[model samples]
Target chain A: MLMIIRLMIAAMFILTTPWSGLAEVQDESALDIQVREIAKTLRCTVCQTENIWESGAPLAQQMRGVVRDRLKLGHSPEDIKEYFLSRYGDYIMMQPPAHGVNWLLWLGPFILLLGGGLLLYKEVIGWVRRTPANPTAPPPPLDEQARQRLERELES
Target chain B: MNKGTQLTLVLVLLGLFYLFYEGLWGNPRHIPTVLIGTDAPMVEGPDVETGEIISLEQFKGKVVLLNFWASWCYECKVEHESVLELHRLFKDNPNFVMLGVNYQDKLPDAQQYLKEYGTTFAHMRDLKGQLAIDYGVYGVPETFVIDQQGKIRYKYVGPVTGHMYTKITQEIIAPLLKGQPVSTAS
Candidate 1:
């Protein structure tokens, strides 16, 4: 009877015990979600082209860890981004902040396109004005006599 | 194009060319740190030799020189002598304290490094690299000087030797220790 009770107890323990690792991974864990969201926005200082989330560099990995740790400490995502900006300056941002001289970077291309288009338009109008246009009267269709004359010249 | 318009276009072209040149030619190592003149972060870690926990808070009101170094960094080895000399120059001052941050290395390797290259000041082990990140340190052999007000007075990225050593000693640390103004100009 004791053996049967022990067997029942063992079965109950096995069935009821939670798998901590599997639970952490399978469920959309809040911390992992938060880390990914924040990491995706931050440029990896060591690898300038890649964000911390996508980069495999050890520094990037440590940065991801920092993001995770800070999130755990109740820092908002903006606060975390501000933290990095404070450390690495404007260069750290993947998108340069729209401030000061950086305004040129944001708007320079559009301004250039508009300016170039205007310049080209003016130049083309000038060329059209300067050059002679086709005569108003269409040239008479090539006469049979002219065609024959051209053919004779070719033969000669 | 009219004279004014042509001048504007030329100026715009020059500006764009300058930006392109900077993007291509600027040194990747020379990241401008924003922490200068800001409050220095208090860092804590285990003593590299003794394994006892050391906190930067205890060194408040002193001119703290935090040098970040690693076991494998060649520049750290190169600057090691000059770093020691700098410490020796100011170690007698009651207002000055120098802390060595052993960064991103194994415990045994760090202890071996301190053993091989004599260390006079307390060295802290940055186990998870949090301490280095706290100071925005991307590489070894970076140095920072914090003033009595706990603001980061100066930071140098590379090895401190030659003219750099002279500059840090006379122009930076000495002035801060005396509570005089030092230029934080970039």
Candidate 2:
């Protein structure tokens, strides 16, 4: 009976230790996933065309780690992003900020759209104003000098 | 119109034209990039050789140079020399560390490429693309320079050469080494 009890206790410890270790590893991996999600939105400065998440560049990888560390330290996502922005400038963001000098990056297209709409409106109004109301009104007689000039131009 | 009035009008028009030109051609200096100075994202993956789990947190308090690359990317291959150079330069500098993230390439291919290039830097295989996504990587050959404080200080988006290395070192690394706050702009 004593031997059986000791054997059972040893078995339990052996089984539970690995399980606990596995759980801790899983937790760490989960935290990594969370950090990765936040890093994906940032652009890599070295490869301006690629985001930090996609590039295999060394710097991107380091920055991803840095972001993770900051997250672990209890910094909010926004704080992490702002911290990078202050050091690297707007080029580091995949999407440029809308404030300060970068507002144009966000608003330039809308401004162009409005300007285009206004120009189209003006053109349509000018066309309407130039059109005569009555289609069948006899055409105003041309002055003799104007008629002569038109005839000469057409002939040439 | 009098000459003075004509001159004034001309000057105003010129000024307006200049403003538009600047708007089109000039990006504002020191406009903060969204990711600049931000905390780096956590990235973890299997070690390229050992298949052991590697986490970014392991290298805390060291200046890290994270490089993203691939076996098939031509620009990455072009920049490989500079990467090797940087490694050689900083190999003895305990405060500096460089990590290579293999983006979307087979493990064998990446290992072979690195072998051919003679790189001694440590690398992680981001086989499932999870690590890459965390860094917001759009393509390979991007680099991020993180300071000892773990803030991302510099980013280089394309193939880097010797000239780029010098410029970045002078503008970013040298300042940090001297205990001065780095200027974020070129």
Candidate 3:
């Protein structure tokens, strides 16, 4: 009877141990997913091309981990991103800050468009001014020979 | 058209072309460095094990692979083996060095991590992360390849893998050893 009991316990331990490993693996991958999600929103300081999640840089990876740990600790994503911004400055962010010097990064394109529109307007006005007013009267009809030559040129 | 108008039109067209060129061909992959080719920043902190004060200048005259990592970083764990491999690969190569900077980690946690992972290189704690700021480190696991001349030659912003290991050996290390300019991908 004792031997049978020992066998049952051993079986139970074996079954349960694998579950622990599975749980750990699940937790780890869950963490990875969360980190990736957060990293996707944060810019990579080094690459300047993609967010930290998309970047292959070790630093970006590390930052992803930082985000994950912060999430685990219950810090809001905004706070975590803000923490990094405070430390590394707006240049580290893929999206420039909305205030201060980076206000230009946000508003520069619109400003450029306005300037371009003004320039276009000025050029069009200048061209209209320089162009001789369209002749009020139509030109005389060309002779048959001239018309034939023009037709030939068009055909060729 | 007036000369000024014509000139302005040409200039605007040229600017558009330049913008397109930058969008397509600029060094998008290159991480902007506030510290490229600059001397290693001043870092003073306790060594990972000994609690001895360590500074960046101490690693002068050697090629340093300064890695920023944290215990909480998952990718750091993923690339931990690669770091160990690098440490082993260059164990006897005194000219090459690997240093870890524990970014914003508590001492006990950092110690537990070293114990768990097996420390292959000396690490310094970046208590205030001023070192990371100085190095322009935006994220963890950023590796800087400093040449023997003490100038930072390359910066890898992500995980170091077997393929990257081979590439580093061929493109960065071999060329530097041959006294040639480092061929950067950017």
* lDDT on C-alpha atoms for all candidate structures: 0.86, 0.74, 0.75
i-RMS of candidate 1? 2.9
- Say which prediction, candidate 1 or candidate 2, comes out ahead on lDDT: 1
Candidate 3 chain A, which ten residues in sequence have the lowest lDDT sum? A85-94
Window of ten residues with lowest summed lDDT in model 3 chain B = B22-31
The DockQ assigned to candidate 3 is: 0.07
Fnat by candidate, in order: 0.36, 0.15, 0.10
Q: What is model 2's interface RMSD?
A: 8.9
Model 1 lDDT per residue over A76-127, tens place: 9999999888887776677779999778877877877777777778789999
For residue B63, model 2's alpha carbon misses the true position, in angstroms, by 1.1
Q: What TM value does chain B of candidate 3 have?
A: 0.78
TM-score of chain B of each: 0.90, 0.78, 0.78
Best-fitting candidate, scored by TM-score? 1
Q: Write the per-residue lDDT of candidate 2 for residues A1-156, one digit (tens) a residue.
A: 999999999999999999999999998997788777777877765564577788887667778877888888889889988866655556677787778856765765565565555556766887999999997999999999999999999999
CA shift at A100, candidate 3, in angstroms? 19
Cα displacement (angstroms), candidate 3, residue A54, comes to 26
- Better candidate number, 1 or 3, judged by lDDT: 1
Runs of candidate 3 with Cα error greater than 4 angstroms are A1-108, A115-156, B1-30
